[model samples]
Target: MVKQFVRQKARNITPTQFIVFTYLTAVMVAALLLLLPASVKEGKSISFLDALFTATSAVSVTGLTVVNTSETFSGFGALMIMGMIQFGGIGIMALGTFLWLIFGQNISLSYRRLIMVDQNRSSLSGLVYLIRSLLLLALLFEGVGAVLIGSYLLAAGYYDSVPMAFYHGLFHAISSYTNAGFDLFGDSLQSFSNDYVLQGLTMVLLVLGAIGFPVLIELREKLVKKTPNFKFSLFTKVTVTTFVTLIILGTVGIWIVESSVYYREMPWHQQLAYSLFNSISTRSGGLATMDVSEFTSPTQFMLSVLMFIGASPSSVGGGIRTTTFAVIVLTLVNYALGRSEVRVFRRTLKQEDITKSFVVFSAAVMIVILSIMLLDALERQHFSLIKIVFEVCSAFGTSGLSTGITSELSAPGKVLIILLMFMGRVGILTLLFMFRSKVTKDRYHYPKEELIIG
Candidate 1:
């Protein structure tokens, strides 16, 4: 039976399924490894459920910790979590490809097809070259970020040991770049709110990570090939424009609402930095230099919206995705203008693309609703419903921001969050597609019927 199962799987498995399975398998393994006595600093073993929860959060790169990451886990455990984040960011398949590259193994045609689809590459022909470029780009950016952040932290006298400071820099740099929202600082970067240097470096990391892998690869190709005539694809243009617009709008909105309270305490330059960081982080990065819970009601509402929009397609961060958001907006504009085509940059958007956007959007909203209801049922608290919804959305979007209520959640509440993290990371559309099969219809004519709407 086992041999039969393996043979059947071999015949049917796709690379995307393999990638997803690899991540889920890693999550389970990491959970068990983390529960070991050596993983905890005080040598206390973690419960199965707690281990599973932590592993899911880290592997999903959601950053919602059931236990205090900084205090509960030993250095070895922290490194394990960091490894999970890196794997989650580039994807398990991509990591496997990286290993193959290091070993100088030629990428087979099948592997190339998988990489192209999984990474959302435009063309499958140069898949191996693209994968190599992506790995090099990631390393270079991460290396620079680690150095600058490490130097700043050392200058600030934040750590006594050189290795500690370096590790802290390396941890947060990778964490931020991956949009994992995990921090060596237990308070999650709040200690550096007033520190301008750290804040700026972090912002850069967030932006780079939020942009999808495809965009990064394209940008790198332009730089290396020196193709001055290289044009941005419509998808890239829309994603960049939408992301920038959202950041700007979120920054301005947060500034206006929270400036008198949160920003008033800091100098003008620092206030701008704080506002910008929160705006970028809100869209699924979840790193907050300031205490986001202390923000005014309006500011929290704004953050909820940003978190819902989240990051771009095939990026480290999650949400319905920036491209989905752009499609929805474009569709709306086309409708208002009475145009048949949802065109942008002189390119007509595909009907399938718009339909998929609606499906993704609907699935996301439904998940948020269902999660909020479940949390309310589990917690049995009198907390504001809006805040709970925000938390649910954050988890499902893999944003990891909270109103400082994650630790207070009951066991069932934590479980709910774990499920949400998995759903968000795997993505609602991907999940749907996994269970759905393509259907074929005959050419025979059927009786035409029309239904009235609205």
Candidate 2:
């Protein structure tokens, strides 16, 4: 009877609720797996809470760790974390759907709805095709990335043995492509600071991972299949434009603030490299060429802002997302120019899209501010406010970049960060919708009123 009730309830749950539960289940299972003795190093032990936190971080693709990943996790544990990163990067729903297809099981409407919500799709058309392409592309990119980086490491004598070199390469490749900031390298990409070739490859993979899948699909269509007269959607245009614009602004912004301070005596080339790589990573890459704690407070705040904006929608990373940020900016521009509606790329934006954008932005601001306040209250005595703020934004954005204070936080602080990471991964909109009723609507409308404009 109990089993029947659960089966019945599962069938009737809303897509949003189902998504939450699915991700939650994944986190719990991963946490339990991490708690096993085989998953830890010979002398290291892990508490359930720390395991949960690490699991959440891994499944969210957020790299914030309560323990040193390299020192704590055994080889099996590291491999498990990599698997979780891949699973989280592609999504649990995508993986389940892929398995179903493999077994030649039919994908029903219910399955499609889950996929739509998981991938943040607006429509239900061609979902099966999308999953197939996603899996295929993931393989192609990861395979090529591992070979290039691993082979380079071996040839460059970074690793004496072939297996170890390729294993490390494969791990880093998955992490980079998934925007999963977890690293086997103790200092992230810091040891490779002067290795332009590795840095360049990693950045390319990061961008590809965070840039929305829709844009990638369309690009693949045009570039690979040579689709004739292919036109880009408004979403792709806005997303790409905002994404590129932010990278430029972030790079320039970092350079500007650092020029008179940290980079005062540094050469121009090194300065550019640091500025550019940090800018890109700030937007969800999480990998770093240098210690971010060395930067001025202003620069750290700047990095926080980019993390809050985050990667493009339908991608691995999180925040309010690039489109949401773009919509808010465009709306302000339209109003300032005496226009009524947001317009871009020769197309007018829908009213619903604009409203939803504001909703996301407002909710994100509220959540982020509250989390920062709460963390400040808890840990301000031990850490700087700027560091706390950066950490909070990092959790919410799922960027995983930290100021070396992650492991030192109080128990409550770590829990708060874990919740923030979960929220960041599943999204603010999802959380909001989880409480909304699916069966109820107002039968009659009240008279509308307008307040004085700001």
Candidate 3:
């Protein structure tokens, strides 16, 4: 039976392998569904490369579409994309666990291990509860978002009928809260650029999604249970602090860099709205209110930096992660100060954590640089270097914000971006681990040697 074979295969592979396999499977399935005749508009067939690219983007929850989602895909196709977003956003294992619980099936030890790795938990304890809580919270947040957005759209006559408005609202609600960034609006919310209610709601949903599920869980517990004298975990503190700091800095940075060029004719409120939305969107939200190309080169470069840093770990978004960036900075600061240890919040970090942070950061930079180089060679004549770099970073960070070069990319360029999106979703470290050789104990120690380094 298929179930027996799957169980056997699952037993033979590590959790990391299983996770990668799950995403690949999801991508393939989504691609096939997207290629279906019903999935596309009448009489139009999707190209294999574009279909695969869109599927990968949706399954990875990265919104870098090679085709215009609203015009190219039918309602059924759009729903299929939404399904992939949900699967990728919350993860396939989490959804599987929820179904297993609903069916009254026992979650085996191996299944628990999969869940642990999927959610980035260190232990197996309370994983079922965690899944239930995660799903419930996701539904609640997304449901409220849908209602609010739908009501506003209908009241404002954005759509002709209630059903159409509701569908768009629901689609955007899921997309925003999952940080999937796919949009039904042709220009990706440009019409609503000055609409404070929609933008504010979207920003909040994006933050909640990108802040990591564990942090949300902790916040829920603290706020709902009213825990007395409660303190947040170090992870929560570091992630929140870094996330907020980046938003503030990015907003100000973009405003200062582009005020003279991009926003010179706009009012102060419109300027603020654009800056804030773009800042948050660059951090893996990807739903832009305006064309990214309108900004100056310096502003585009800064947005690229924001996208490269991305969102928090164990969340829907990608990039090197907030904590990793924070650790790298802290490590440098301490080293410059000649300190014995890198400490944050009066707590000393483990040597392994520091090493891992550096590895992740360095590896990410290498991947982005290499990707940019490849893209430049492929599309240099067609696009500017800054646009190429921005696209590469968007793919790597899974940020999905583009300067209008996505559709113009050649076949090879699309494939490269597809690979970057996959790597981003699976994570640099996870991908490295997937190819890492098995460790073996040595019977004897090698002679120690010292090498000079900067």
TM-score of each: 0.94, 0.98, 0.96
Off by over 4 Å in 3: 1-10, 437-443
The positional error of residue 26 in candidate 3, measured at the CA in angstroms, is: 0.8
How does residue 255 of candidate 1 score in lDDT?
Answer: 83
TM-score leader: 2
Give the alpha carbon lDDT tens digit for every residue of 1-454 in model 2: 9999999998778899989998999999999999999999998999999999999999999999988888899999999999999999899888998899999999999889889888888789999998888888888888999999999999999999999999999999999999989888888989998888899989998999999778888889988998999988888999999999999999999999999999999999889989999888888888898999999999999999999999999899999999999999999999999998778988999998998899999999999999999999999899999999999999999999999999999999999999999999998888888888875778999999998976
Check candidate 3 and list the clashing pairs. Answer: none
Question: How many collisions per candidate?
Answer: 0, 0, 0
Model 3 alpha-carbon miss at residue 410, Å: 0.4
lDDT ranking, high to low: 2, 3, 1
Error of 1 at 372 (Å): 1.1
Model 1, 1-454: lDDT tens per residue? 9999999988687655765676689889999889888889985567888888888888888888767889889999999999998887777668879999889898888888677656654467767776677677778888899988888788789987888888999999999898999987998988877777888898888889888766887776577776788987787788889999999998888888877887787777876887888899989888888677788777887888788888998688888889999999999999999999999989999898899999999888888887888888876565677678778878887888888878778778888988888877877766775666555787798899999966
- Model 3 gets an lDDT of 0.92
Number of the candidate with higher TM-score, 2 or 3: 2
In candidate 1, list every pair of residues with a backbone clash. Answer: none
Deviating ranges (above 4 Å) for candidate 1: 14-16, 43-45, 120-125, 260-267, 439-448
